[model samples]
Structures are given as C-alpha cells and as structure tokens.
Target: MQGPAVSGEEEPRPLLRTMLGDVLRRNRREQRRTLEDVARAAKVSMPYLSEVERGRKEASSEVLAAVCDALRVELSDVLAEVGRDLAADRVRRERVIRLDVALGRRTARPARRSGDTYCLAA
Candidate 1:
C-alpha cells in the first residue's frame, strides 16, 4: 500500500481507517476502559468493535455514533481530534524538509513532479 518515497515527492497522507482507529484506541485507553465494556454499552459485538479499533474493518456512521456514545465522547469531538492530528502531521513533514535544508544535507537534484505541479531543481 506504500511506495518508496523519492526526493521532492508529495507528502503521503495517512489512511482514514488507520487514523480513526488510532483515535478510538487513544480515547478508550485514556478513560481506562476496555473494549468489552464499550462494546457492551454500545450494543455492538465485542469482536466487531475490536476489529474496528484495529482498523481491520470500517464502521458505519451509525456504529461510529454508538461507539462515541458508549465512550461518553461526542462524535464531533472525535472528528475534531482527527482533524488536529492530520494538521499536525502536515506540519511535522514540512518541518522535516526545512531541517534537511538547514543541515545542508540536500544536494542539487533534477526537477521532480509532485502531483500536478513540478518542483524546480535546486
């Protein structure tokens, strides 16, 4: 699902399922709760809930709402946290590029196309 990233390649985006799973697991752990407890409260099967948390399965909107309710968290809040994480990831990637330039580790390279635009060679 991933390819070797070359110099000047566009930043890769994280999979939505993976990000959602990470947030769900974080929230559950923060409340010192177990998957069984939340699944029971949400009326979702324990194994299904486990799969969702592991990103092995994608949950429907109804399931997501139910899980949020069981976790005592607002669905909107969960989404907001995911948004924040994505933004942070973008910033972190940009920082790494800047640091590379600052350390003079980058050398002259041919122009590289990133998406629809081409980055001029330096």
Candidate 2:
C-alpha cells in the first residue's frame, strides 16, 4: 500500500472550504444580504449556512454551487479569487525566503511548538 507523502509537495496547504466561505460571505455582505436572505435563496437552513460561512462546516459541491447561485456569483469567480490570494501569499513567502537566504539561514520553516513555547532549533 502507498504511504502518505511527506515531501515533494511544493505549495502550502490550502483550506478549500474556508476560502470558499470567505468569498461567499464577502459577496453576500457586499450585496447587503443576510444569512436569512441567502440561505432562503439557496434553499438551505439559516444555521447551516451560517456554519458554512464560518468554515465550521464542509459543504458539498452542490451546496456550494447553490450558495454561489444565490449570491449571483460564478463559482469560477470564487475559485479565481482564492487562487489570487494563494498567489499573493506565495509571493510573500518567496520574499521571506530571499531575506532568510541573505541572512544565512538554510530554511525558514516556523519553529515547532514544544508545550508552553516554540523550540528554536537553529
């Protein structure tokens, strides 16, 4: 059986549902819509929609498409925005990597936490 991959993954992990929810919530708010409004239009419950918007729930693709339809946004547009955010973060990381290299650091991973504080192995 194949094992989990530990290396060869270049991109940072992307939280799909959270990013989708953020995009949906922003669009809904921009249109002056409420949970009650969008939820009703999407044919979902208020509490469930709220949870989805807060990223506490992992919604199915069907549900997401319905929500986007309710918000009058194309699903591709939401994905595009998420892609843009990820790209911006990559740029920031690359800058940090350059600075770390100039400062003589081999790698710039965040310090691992050890109980009450982070361990500075370097």
Candidate 3:
C-alpha cells in the first residue's frame, strides 16, 4: 500500500488558532492559573482545554466565549481578534478568486443579458 503523497506546497499555517492559543496561554500565565484550573472554571474538560491551548483544536465561538468569561476577560476582545482574522482570510480568498477569474480557471456569471447578448451556462 502506498502512503499519502506529499505536495510540494507548504501546509497553510493556522494563524487564528495560533493567536488564540497564545492569548489563552498568556492570560492564564498572567493570572497564575493552571490548565486544570481554567478548565474547571470554564466548564471544559482538561484534555480539551489543553488541545485548545496547543492550537490542536478549533473551538466554536460559544466555547471560546465561555473560556474567555472564565478567564475574567471580555468576549469582545476575543471576538475582535477573531473578526480581524476572518476579515484577513476573506481578503486572501477574494484575491485568489480574482486571480482565478483572470486566468479563466473560474468564470463570472452575467447579471443581466443585453438586447442581443446571451449568458453562457457555467
């Protein structure tokens, strides 16, 4: 049996995940709290919290908000960071889409057909 083939392209780094993990670790350290302690306070399992802290898992917004509340931090702070990350991701995606359109790898649909013009089905 053949193993999975490696692509020459580098694996994309999860910047948002890394940022969340770093923020959680930094806040916990500043508060002198252990992972177990934070887990208990956040009502999350120790292992799950550990995974979150290590950026091995992507937490839902609700879970993240719960964790932030347990850490005595405002949800807005975390959400703001999340928003910024999402915006950046959206921009990157748009850029890729534009490039694809330019290269004809992707085609745009016409909004309306002129008198004699017809839109081709994509």
Candidate 4:
C-alpha cells in the first residue's frame, strides 16, 4: 500500500509495475494491435494480458518474453525503455527533494501519533 501524500509535496515515485505496463500499452497502441491479438499470439489469456497492461498484475519473465515476442519486440528493448523511464522519474524525485530541503520543509514521513515508533528500515 502507498503512504498518504504530504501537503504541497510532489507525489512519490511511481511503482515499477506501473511504468512497465505503460510501456507495454504504449507499444501495443503504436503497433495498432489489440489485446486479443497479442494475447492469442502470446498464448496468454486476454484478461491476464489486460491486467498486466493495467498494472493490476505482475507478469513472470516467461510471460513477458512471450508478450514481447507477440509484439515483435525484444525483451531487452522493453527493459531498456523501462530503465530510461525510471531514470527520468528518479531525476524528478531528486529535484523535488532538493527543493523541499532548500525551503526548509520536512520531507520525511507524514506526522504520526505521539509515542508511535515507526521503523522505516528495510
């Protein structure tokens, strides 16, 4: 689950799943292919492909390879695109964090109840 956004703060970095889905959907659209077309070619259920495109499901490596093959694209190419997307997102987040710090804003987690100890270590 995502944490609540702080007032006047930029939104958090998007999930990788979300970005991956966006790339897939964009590629499909650019190729003028429908979900059913790709799903059939990939030997995957149409609904499952749809869920993956919507970022509602995390697809396995095998499935991703199949989907890329169906789309006539390379898995490495798709991954590279995702990498670029993540890099851009990181730059944006860093900019926001720097701005917040410059303005003396508290950029940590949102305020919690007194005596509540939160461990953010992963």
lDDT (0 to 1) per candidate: 0.80, 0.77, 0.72, 0.83
Which pairs of residues clash in candidate 1, taking residues 3 or more apart in a chain or in different chains? none
- RMSD (Cα, Å) of model 1: 9.4
Clashing residue pairs in candidate 3 are none
- Assess every candidate by TM-score: 0.68, 0.65, 0.54, 0.70
Model 2 reaches what TM-score against the true structure?
0.65
lDDT of 2 by residue, 2-120 (tens): 22233534556567777767778889999999899999999999999999988789999999899999998898998899788777666544421234544666875677677655322
Mind giving the per-residue lDDT tens digits that candidate 1 earns over 10-76? 6678777777878998999999999999999999999999988888899999999999999999999
**Candidate with the greatest lDDT versus the true structure:** 4
Model 4 gets an lDDT of 0.83
In the range 75-108, model 4's lDDT, one tens digit per residue, is 9999999999999887555422234444567768
Number of the candidate with higher TM-score, 1 or 4: 4
Clash count in backbone of candidate 3 = 0
Native-vs-model 1 lDDT? 0.80
- Arranged by lDDT, best first: 4, 1, 2, 3
lDDT of 2: 0.77
Error of 3 at 10 (Å): 9.1
As for lDDT, the candidate ahead, 2 or 4, is 4
